[model samples]
Target: MALIGRISLDVVARPQEPTAKKRCLDEPQPDTLKRAKFSDEDYDANKRLRKFQESWKVTYPWVTHEAYDDDQKPGLMFCATCRAYPDLADKSSALYVGCSNMRVDPLKKHEFSSAHIKATNKKTKDTMTMKERSELATNSPIVKATKRCMQITMNILVVMFNTVYSLAKKCKPLSDFETHMELHVKNKKDIGGDYMDIGTNYHNEKRAKEFLMSIGEQLRVTKTRLIEKVRFLTVLADGSTDSSMTEQYTVLVRYVSEGYPVTTLASIEDIENANAFGVKNGIENGLNKIGITDSSKIVSVNFDGAAVMMGCKSGVSALMKEKNPRIVLIHCVAHKLELGVLDAVRSIDYLLKFEDIVKSIYKFYARSTKRRRDLQAFADILESELLHYGDVKTVRWVASKARALRAIQQNLFATLGHLEHAASANKTEESGKAKKLLHEMKSARFVKYLHLMMDYLEIITATSKKFQQNKLLIMEVPDIIKSTTDELTLMIEEPGHQTSTFYDHYDPETGDFTDHGDHVMKLSGQRLTTYEEDNDKTTLLKQTVKYLEVRFMDFNEKPLKCFDAFNLNKWPTNDTELVKHGRDDIKELTQHYIDILTDTEHSSMLREWTIMKNLLRKKKTGINCHDLYCELLQTQPADIQNILTLVNIMVSISPSTAECERQFSAMKLIKSCRR
Candidate 1:
């Protein structure tokens, strides 16, 4: 709209001046047709100052100075506080203020609406409010009279406008229907509904996000009704990169509990640029929403125990320190347990050996889809009637080596049968390889000792009805140590006790003894009479005594307290295996311990089978307790699963999401739709 002041010049008749000659007006230049350009500093500034002063006079009459020079532009700019050097020559642009939108805090932007009452309470039968006076155009006489009055007023205003500046504004507010129109306009478009046609739609997409945030707030408030409200919560944040994708993570309390399952999630905040102080921003924003923040209420900020997360700069822990150094960074226990188990399982001999065998065996059996199916079928058949998932069926875990040991034993017979069939079908070298595996596998003690390696609970199924049930042993510190020590001494002493008996002489070439070397010989000479006699007696006696005293001690005592019972019952009364012919087979090798577990040790372990049965209480209850142990009554160890089971026992009994899994799940769903 352009403004022009009217100028009137009246002619004073001077001797009846002759009429002026009419000259043709040349057509305007094409360049002159161009609309007015605003390239001048002084003119634009003067106009803006005048307009600003006029607005001030109407809206802020308290200001003293109203007059303004357009060339000087008496405008206080939104960006006048910007850090820049101001120059007088730069009046074409800003001296200090620059082109930028003013900051508007959401709560400060608009006035609330007791001022904007609807004419007829739309949903209720209340009287009309002033703002709604224009909308109450019902068929009732009062409403009709009001509508006619409004129309007459509007017509009177149009006539008045002809006397003033000739209707410079293009847009006009509707005379009636103000309240209903306000509601309709809001329903059709975005927010800021007061000025109907100002087009606030695309400019305020952040409002959509703000609306979603309100929903999240409602969810958190509902979920946290059961928890102790933290006055201020310190957000724990991290950035996770998955397959080169990055997301910002913020953790806040959503659930309420005094002790156990305490919190749930409100939302996931993906970091856009990861502002240098996202942690600070997150903490501040979160605390503000919770509506009770003091710097003191932020007592803790726990983070993943990574170096970066606790480092001195932008770490979640460190960031909180930047604000309040008193905020603590606690370590997550599950992570610590993983580190522990990783350490303990290293350098374990059996596991290393087992891993080697399993990697090979699993690879071979898992070669094709058919073979994998066959394995599952074999596991199922071994499980009879129908397989329950719990039936010692193989599943891979971190210590997969241990499971592999059981696997070799459980399916040995079935494996051998399959290989034999394979040999019959194809007698090639590959088949020969299978035959070799069968042969080598058949030699291992796993098949013979399979029952010993299984969980005691499984053994209860195969147990004889005649035998007594085992008892679980709850071990106290003293008892555990006592059992361990006694078992070791017993194993060590037994061998010597057996060798205490006298044997005379044995033939050199054949083991058969001459009559002089038969049984029941005495300590014939305290001192040897001759060198030959001295040599023989000293050689034999010293060797036998040394073997019992030193070597046996080491072998007997090395196993853990859990295996103590085996040492007690499996000990040797005599170093001999009885043959079918009822003769003793004597061998120097019995003391050599070719098998990792000695026979006497195995026997002793079997004798105290009740103790072995107690070790696996963590897996099943009352299943392995034999009748004898039941008669005796012993407490058993807790059935634990993985290392995390302890953490599960201690911290997770409360049952809230320990992480933002649920909130993240919803957020992920949204992103999936976007893709």
Candidate 2:
């Protein structure tokens, strides 16, 4: 008190402190009235938002469990109407809003209304304040139950999402979620980053496994979209790195006989060797887990052609011998097919050069995050729609698809234009080389023949599947096989089919365009004006039709009762027909593949293996010796043992990489769905 008096005296002496403002003690004015207003524009916007929400609600049911954006946060059982309208306004007007429970629940709100029955707020016996009311119902059981129901729906959605991507579509958003949600359930489980899924928590391992099993069980309950009944299971194992850099192996098994591609079994395996062993066992277990097993029911095992899985005599291939001794070890044909194309590209001088340029471009574009973005920008600037959206039809020149080669032949000049422009900003030795390569690519003799391959691929891929499924509609495999082989042989043998040079050959005998020699001998040279466009189209059309017919015909000969049925064809007369057809097809495919691979840097050595498999098929009496090599080679061959491995891949394994490839497609959708 003394200190205060001293300060006050000091202030008075200083004269700096103005006379203390006299307090205005008069009472304040009364509060102003509040009014509500509405506009057509606001009404329209609200209607639109409502429509969007409702649409989302139908598409994404999990949203039902989710707290509405405008709803109250956890702790209340809000009526839908009241949840939508959280505040009451215009008491004298008909437009009313507020928690419906507050109006209808006599215990909570004595004046509750559903059909707008008017009610007045009645004082409780204690005349409780707002704080007192909340305190008495803080852990409200009704609110908790509402939240629990929401949690159940969310759990259902999560389980569905893990099994299939097309489950959860979209849900609408609300303006006020908090006012409606009296008891909210937060993310109760850790979601995985890989696939938008309820993630695995080691602390909850047993629960997670059970949940995963339940997901599988749920899929079974989902009307069993599986088209094919269980048959010879064709297993394929391939390893890949996830976003987290963990090396995960995916094992897929196809149940043959189904014409359409369907995943009969799928599983993700571990990385450790024990894990590798575990993965293999897990695959076997999962097959049983998905209803598979018994030795003879399993027909083929296809892998990445890795020695770890394919080595002769001692690997998993042999382990299968104890189960199904005749189970063939097939290599993924797409891998070999691609390898063949790479090999073929490597054989040609300009094509090889062009491929190298493409490699350089791919590397530059794919080197890092910044580079990829720059590549996209460059693509946009160049407006080269053919910068390979990552497909077979437009993979530069070498890695291009069979049908695209023809288009690429004509488009080579245009592609060069893109490469030239792309090179302008790239001031390196690569740029200069690329410019020269641009010219070679356009002039390359084999350009026109690339499309011819489309017919071949169409024939092979379709026919291969039909043959595997025993659903080939064709009669007499030999007749069709012979004709088909002869057709391709004859096509390749055509004089104009393989031109050697870009310009007309100047015949020394006549010094004119008239002395145009056979072009087949000149395939190593270039293109000519005589090359007819209709000729290519006609031949492709013929081949494609014939191929399709044969494939369908093949379906009739031996309905594919098993997956990976390479040699699964019935013997025309003897018990050896399956082996014969398999041997012949492998040789032919390997040749065509090798023909494509003549120049590829990464040689798949399918040709060598094709020969080896044929030799095995021929030696009918040497089961003991052949069986020795089978076990030895199928287990794990040394680095030098690739030749033996390649044969087993082509002769015995999955005809195509469709199982894993389909998985890849599914993975893409899964990622987007999760995101």
The 0-to-1 C-alpha lDDT of every candidate, in the order given, reads 0.35, 0.43
Structural similarity to truth (TM-score) of each candidate:
0.32, 0.41
lDDT of 2 by residue, 1-675 (tens): 999999999888985646785646595544563356889988876752211233433533212223345644321222232233334222332223222222122322312343222112222314678897886565579867877777866865565334232231122111112211211122333332443333232223234335445665876544233422443356767666554555666677655232222344456655565433555675675455454546455656766556656557656666665666455555454454344434443444544554454454444334455534544555454444333323322454322443344444433334445556646755676567556555554443334433344444544444344334421211223334445456555544443332433234333233222112322221224333343443543454344445434433323332222212233223233535433434444344344334222343125444444444454455534443324444545454443244543333233334555456555545444334323
Worst 10-residue lDDT window, candidate 2? 174-183
Question: What lDDT would candidate 2 get against the real structure?
Answer: 0.43
User: Cα miss at 395, model 2 (Å)?
Assistant: 3.6
Per-residue error (Å), model 1, residue 350: 4.8
RMSD (Cα, Å) for all candidates, in order, is: 32.2, 28.6
TM-score of 2: 0.41
> Which candidate's TM-score is highest?
2
The weakest ten consecutive residues by lDDT in model 1 span 578-587
